[model samples]
Target: MAKETLLTYLDEQIEKKLADFDVAIDWDTRNHTIEVIVRLYAENTNHMAIDDREGVRSEEEIIEFEDAILLYDDQKAVFDEDDYLAVIPFAGKKGMQQKVIDALIMYLPEILVKGQDDLLDFLVSDEESIFELHFSPDYFQALQADMTTAKQERFLPYPSY
Candidate 1:
């Protein structure tokens, strides 16, 4: 199918089920193949309250917004000289990489994106099949190595819901 056809199909599908997610994808036509820029907005949960005789502010801290650049069947010049994708500005903090990947894998079944099944298989294992996603980055190898050491040396158990 032509790229335009595919793009239209995806847009319609996402629009139909827009309530499922809080993110959106924008297509870039200037490139040759099907390329898209993904963006996710950070949630704001700010509120003010009066305590005794004073006012206090409480809100969820904004860690960072989730974002990525994707290419379908094409790997053009998306990366810069520093190995960061020009389109995807935020690579996220090192500690939060796994969490971000997990979110991506958990939402892999969405029909709007291509290669859903393949990404599902790679990102998730049987036990964590429900909430795991893999990030395909040039530095993934080194990160994984460090992650393994961290997991082994400083791992702690937490109750799983």
Candidate 2:
């Protein structure tokens, strides 16, 4: 079997899982980090959106709305989070790296099956793992830098799907 970095492996896995959506990925091998951005470039369907008819919110109405929606759901990224690059750093114990890798493998398919998730949480993995998710300017600098990249790939939408 050929060995690959977590980013490389996950990139291939995500490429396959999100075949229906567009994905952009880049990695900084020097930093052992991977950055991914998922774009929902879905074509608008014929179905029109309907309003709930509950307009003009008061504090109580806002609270009720908040109660109804899950803002930080780990199963789906906040609408804005998907627009920004989600960086997953893999550097530490081999076993933990594998675990994080495993999680990433499972995550992309979950998103496809459900079409969304608590995606921002990948920025931090606590005591149970070695990965860390960071959105710092420095990381972005490295990712954007012309010299630090080890691998990058993009998957465009399927022509018919």
Candidate 3:
């Protein structure tokens, strides 16, 4: 199949995975080689929106939401303009955690490419495609919301870790 078709296939598969959330695939239009990841996020930015004036922020609200963030627009006195996605304290709700896990599970049995020499090489190699989009595709990677815990664990092998 064509690459565009495959990307569409990726979207189509993710679209059908759940009923409550949206999965957006941000393709690396610049690199176009060995750069592919599917990112699924909940529409929490709007839900987590506080008023134009500063309002109370819950500890849970501060932790669970991590997509777009409230930017301190100097021109205005409020922090409603969110152009950042920062990683602060990351302890989320059980349901939010489960949704993230479900999305990962929905795509775990597949890869974007095949013929990986090893885990490290597979992680580093540039990509072209040759695998089942639903099964184990040849070259691809995936990301979802709330992977901070997983990311922290993955870096535990480093000296600085």
User: How does candidate 1 score on lDDT?
Assistant: 0.33
Kindly list the per-residue Cα lDDT of model 1 for residues 1-161, writing each as its tens digit. 53323345444545664545544555444432223333332333332121211223324333122334343213432433332122222221111233222223334334224334433332333343222223445443344454443323331111121
TM-score of each: 0.32, 0.36, 0.25
Cα error, residue 127 of model 1, in Å, equals 22
* Candidate 2 lDDT, 1-161, residue by residue in tens: 64464445656776776676555565433333335554432221322222322544222211111101111213322244433334333223221233443444445443433332221221122332221122344533443343322233322111110
Ordered from best to worst TM-score, the candidate numbers read 2, 1, 3
Candidates in order: C-alpha RMSD to true structure:
17.8, 16.4, 21.0
lDDT, candidate 1, at 90:
22
Q: In model 1, what is the error at residue 37, expressed in angstroms?
A: 4.6
Question: Which stretches of candidate 1 lie above 4 Å from their native place?
Answer: 1-4, 33-60, 72-161
In model 2, the runs with Cα more than 4 Å from the true position are 1-3, 29-32, 44-87, 92-96, 112-161
Superior by lDDT: candidate 2 or candidate 3:
2
Q: lDDT per model, in order? A: 0.33, 0.35, 0.28
Error at 58, model 2, angstroms: 28
Model 2: worst 10 consecutive residues (lDDT sum): 61-70
Candidate that would win on lDDT: 2
